[model samples]
Target: MSDPSAAGPTIDPMDTSAGNRFAPYSPENHSAPLWIVSILGLIYTIGVLSIRLFIKRRVFGWDDSLIVAGTLTGLVQAIVFFKALKSGLGQVPEHVPNLSTTASLAFTAQILLLIALYLAKCSGILLLRRLFVRDQQNTGRLCDVVLGFTVVCGIATVVMSSAGCPSTGSFTTHCSSTNTRWSVVTALDIATEVILLLLPAYLVWQLQMKTSYKLRVIAAFCFRILVIIFSIFHLIARIKYADTQPSPFNIVTTLVWHQTLLAWGLISATIPNLKAFLQSLSASWGGADWGYTVKAYGNGTFEMKSMGTQSRSHAMASTTGTENATDMDQKYETQIQTRQVGERSSLGSGGSQDMIIRKETVWTVVRS
Candidate 1:
């Protein structure tokens, strides 16, 4: 793969003399990777934005902010890799215009990739923390421990990758050693993902919800399992190219996987915040109030409740103190149970003693 002659007319292997061997630069080779990154970035941005718009109270939380930072770093990494490809990164060494410059750009790109991955992992963990760490549940302790472990692993992988090779010369001379270091980093990446996958499963398993609801929530969180699968694919690709010298194709494949990892991670983190949005969409299409309402109490607390619409109508009709009203209330009482309970503090500065009742009805039909 290092033979420039094998690359055809674009690269001239015969002119191996120092500084005269680089082929004419072309921008086309980078188009695929750039497009992949762009599409993934767009999808991730939409997911995060949807979270803010749909979940109202969850706008730009710690996890969302971290993901935004990660996305920016990922964009930088993609740009650097694109430039490196134009410098002949995947082609034969002699095809590169400036070997030193390519090496430096590759090094920078590698570091940025690591930083983006770290931020992505942390973002997912923070999201899990928000989802599962509320109240006095001891489950929060597990999330804390997993978060600490993820931080340690991310830092360790970055430090090892940076320090494993002192210079570009050493990197070329010790391809096997570099491969070994990357293997460790890949292992750490998979480990962190596994921890994240399990955290949500554990939380959902302990919830006292219906089996169907548990399964639905678990399915949403389980989307990150795709990230784990992608990580394994990346590791396999890295091993396959380990002996071939870092070429443009190898770097492109890595970038593709990296972008995929970022997209899936952001999507998984945003799933929990999408319930209200999905419910609203369903209600709009079905043309019925979905028995969901947002209400504010006098004590500066807000609650969202889901009740049966049919039961609500019957209760309204039976408002008068009559025997039929009493019977209807009892018959429909089972349908008014709370589906999900969330609390938020009011943004106003009114005294706690002030009695205020505010209600906002969000329409949607309840599906049994």
Candidate 2:
């Protein structure tokens, strides 16, 4: 899990490979900007969450619970980061009288950030699971696997941030996050983001919908890419600063990206519900469903139904018959007799015979 590039012994403080990021400048504080953005981001989340709860027949669910948890954790972590900022967190550690306090606060904030992300990411996964858990292809089983992997990786990040990895000492006391620990942690973070993204794409692409509709649904899920982008920035920041000595200057970018990742992660989890809520308004006003409507069924199953000009046709044939109440019978008889008087004149020994034939016909026509 250790990154060879960030090995402490090889790091050159005088060198600018981190590209002027650690340049000596006026000691600045990012507490206010971060606080403002963090508050606004959470408010956005809350606004969407309110709509979600108020929407018709919306029941409190596990995903919603995770959203709430992530939001709360993020709020608390923001406060911790602000406190760290107040104590020379953005200044050179040597210049600060209380380096230990700043380091501890920052470390705690890192753990909390990872925790909030874990919760938010799980919320999004569960929301997606509602759509795929019952797929005929059974990719929901893959969703399950991803969920387990996410949980494992998320916990691993928490462990790595709280206590150093490679079987080292505690985070604040002896173990330093700069020793390739954070590079590994951030790599895992990016991996989770990538995997979460792939699941939605895979599930949506396999759907029985028009290509346009599939794209629309997948586009709706694309909000997560913002999180991934921010995570990539976060990873780069971690790696760039990993070998840099702990100072407010070198840590500011990392701090900003950390906040960015947390806020966006929480917000992305709420986007699906919020997007549907907006689309519902559009639909009420006679607007398009943008190609699909997601229907959540009982037993936590759901599907995205394509919307368009659809027609259904049915045909039926009916026949009636009646039984005849009356019955008729007809009979024909024929008889033949030989006359001896005429035959005796021809031949008395041979006897002549006369034959008679009769024909009768009976007809009936009935229609019902």
Global lDDT of each candidate = 0.60, 0.60
Residue runs of model 1 more than 4 Å from their true location after superposition: 1-59, 166-171, 174-176, 249-251, 283-343, 346-368
Candidate 1 local accuracy as lDDT? 0.60
How far is 275's C-alpha from truth in model 2 (Å)? Answer: 3.0
- Write candidate 2's Cα lDDT for 203-301 as tens digits: 777655456655765676678888878877877887777656545556677777877788788877776665456666664413323322333211111
List TM-score per model, in order.
Answer: 0.66, 0.64
lDDT of 1 by residue, 2-106 (tens): 988877766343333325323322332433454656466756656565554445452346776777787778778768766765666655554557766777777
Provide the RMSD of all predictions against the true structure, rounded to 1 decimal. Answer: 9.9, 28.0
Clashing pairs in 2: 90-248
Pull out the clashing pairs in model 1.
90-247, 90-248, 289-363, 289-364, 290-363, 290-364, 290-365
Worst 10-residue lDDT window for candidate 2 reads 310-319
lDDT of 1 at 249: 39
